[model samples]
Target: MNITKTDVLWNYAATFFKISSSVLLLPIILHKLPSEDVGIWSVFSSIAALVFLIDFGFNSSFSRNVTYVFSGVNSLLTNGHDTSAQSGGVNYSLLKGLLSSMRWFYSRVSLTLFLLLLTLGTFYISRLLNEYHGNKTNVYIAWGLFIAINTYNLYTLYYDALLEGKGLIRVSKQITILGHLAYLLVSTVAIYLGFGLIALVLAQLISIIIIRTISQRKFFNADIIYQLQNCEGDDKKDVLKAIYPNAVKYGITSLGGFMIQKSSIFIGSLYLSLSAIASFGITKQMMDITVSIANIAVATFLPQIANLRIGGNYDRIKAICIRGVVIANLIFITGAATIIFLGTPILHLIKSNTNLNQQVLLVVAFSSLIGLNSGISGAIISTKNHIPFVKPSILSGVATILLLIVFFKFTNLGLLGMAMAPGLIDLCYQGWKWPLVVIKELNIKFSDFKMVIMKTDKPA
Candidate 1:
């Protein structure tokens, strides 16, 4: 098979393997830990995600720059340029220059920002822990694990940016699979030894650190380092300045997304019972696993789309966007059907409780529908650099929160209501608005876009 097809297959296979491992292991964890502890773990996970918001869009901004640089280098080589010549190597030098400057800037700005947020999150979590369980040690351990996980995440994002920019999805997949395997082993051992939540968190962090170290050595060797080192100061500064706006924009957008996804749990904890939070958390985790399959496809296509834009290839960009939407839809339909049919059995295998099963299935079904629709439009928005869409995205998130509050006050739908509220809003707003934005801003014919969806490529 050709390289592109191989990469696509690798990504899908890798995502499935990693997510499957997590799913398999999670039930064992839920069984081992008390339900209350499981609920707390869920809260910690969400808080850790919030820690990443401190990233200030650095990763997204860097990925776009990296992709642009890689594409420029490829274009030069494809056009029969002698890359070894001084001027031929100019673009590489320029890219490295920019990367180095941005890395320095990010290291300084992000470190301070992350530390501040970590402090705030730690204090907030501490208060919640005191109010809920009065367990200080677990809270401290949770914070420790959260820090390790977030730090490792920052490193992994850098590696991922490089891998995706270079179109090395297969290598990326290998790294991910290895990381997940390590986590599975650690989680299993921890459970067997009765180590509780700390074990799980530590295992996850160690797995990421090891995988990132190995991948960095394997894929990003001395040549890339040398390129960065040789970059001129002026060129480096220029790139950093150019990407600053994009980085901030992405950072703001990401915060909105984080709030939408995690706020439900936080709000549920405040307004509903802990058991309700656990039930809802389980459903959300399952939906995340299902959507991750589509995410692999989106990640693979994003760099390509960015490159197409940089190269002024609008037709191919639109075609890829539409095709991506179709693929996402099919995957979602398959996932939703399976969940609707077998969700109870799956939940039984994970948790022996019928109530949990019913609640999880309900949330997963709604989430699947919303995820499928949003995935396509989200891809297009990201590729089109329509950062302004973030305003509406935030609005959708706010609306979700408001609706959840109202539903909780007026209705007895409980956790299911909380889970479905956001999905309902996103399905109505993002699903409709993004397509219209794509058509209006990008000036692509809706019919042609639809044609790309109807056409099929070989399955990944």
Candidate 2:
């Protein structure tokens, strides 16, 4: 499962298509939906992000463990992995247990999520709709579809972990590209046909179906199916127990992450006008795009890093980290620069009512630079099956929220306050601490980092 150059290119292509579809879809969305509808959509998007919180980090834990199983590790561990126990052969018994555990876990979780969204989510959306001046019927219709799609997507989420854990980067990314294409084409046609918000949700439903179906076929090819069928019995409970500790930690960290990145919109909706939320949402969306593109290098190598970790290949991991960090920074800088310089004019060109606030965008760009690198560093640390930054991440999110409350209560900063709060909090801790920890852990020197920046190539 060595990562090939083609794999790298497809990874980039996948991200490109995913982001570009969103970018290309924006003008259409802006034209079709009013600013109020756009603002509502932003809330919907933020709420949808709660799936990450609901997942409680099981996806990453599952994916990392899947990598371990495929890497020939004989047993699972609650904390740290056992590199020395490698058997140099695939453990189909372990794989089968994990697959069973994943299905059992997601089935229950997905049902719970569906119920949560239906009750708590509907209550929240009802509040938003009560103040709405648009057609509430359309929004309600869209909301139902949103719940259905998210629940279905979460149920089939393991396909992603399965593909990436197998180091099928190229295949996984190809599926993403196809999914995004389906979303783009369907949404465009549906919107043009006057479907409005329902169009967006319907398109997403179609895309998720395509992605999951393709991923199932690709990962469960005849050879794998046969192997799995013939494997000895395994204890799903044991596998889950081994995964629970780190999975819980990762869940807490994700909660912190959600608070830091998304709480702003939710809070802003209470304090600011709908137009303000729309502006901030658009800027945040662009920054998210930049971050995702920046993350390509590191994201592509995650399973490989996990495999190398089992083999005690620190030097190789260091090289990937250095190169990944460097590439990520470069992409973020370029993308942020593009958004800062041209984002507003482009909005105007699209005749978009929701304009990006340049001041907020600039601040967010700087903060995002810190955030993306910290994420890369965090990923590096997680390969060793530990998550020490859980406390720091959670603390940062808390501090950011408190500061946001203070700023909004007594200051005139408005959207700038929303942008500045998380940046300042993260800069104090997560922004710098994680990278330093990675450098120390990997024994990376300033000179080595600089050298990697100058000559970024795959390590031997």
Full-model lDDT for every candidate: 0.67, 0.89
Regions of model 1 farther than 4 Å from truth: 1-3, 73-90, 131-136, 231-236, 349-360, 439-460
Question: What's the true lDDT of residue 199 in model 2?
Answer: 95
Worst 10 residues of 2 by lDDT: 451-460
- Model 1's lDDT to the true fold? 0.67
> Lowest summed-lDDT stretch of 10 residues in model 1?
74-83
Model 1 superposed RMSD (Cα): 4.7
Question: Per-residue lDDT for 1-460 in model 1, tens only?
Answer: 1137678888888887688777777778677777667777778767767666777776766666666566554222111122233322336665666557656765665466457647876776665665565356865786677676776576456666677666677888888888888888888898788677777887888788877887778755788767656754346556666666666777777776766667888888877666667777777776767777766555677877766665566776766666666676677668766766776676676663323556646665666566555655666566544466567667777887888798788998777777777677777767567667777755766576556666643212
Q: Give the Å shift of residue 179 in candidate 2.
A: 0.8
lDDT of 2 at 201: 96
Give the top-scoring candidate (TM-score): 2
Question: Compared with the true structure, what per-residue lDDT tens digits does model 2 show for residues 1-460?
Answer: 4776688889999999999899999999987788888998899899889876888989999999989988888889988786666777888999999999999999999999999999998998898776678889999999999999999999999899999999989999999999999999999999999998999999999999999999999999999899998987479999999998898898898888888888999888888877788889989989999999999988899888888877777878888888888888889999999999999899888899788888999998987887888888888888888988888888888888898999999999999999999889888889899889988888888878766777655455
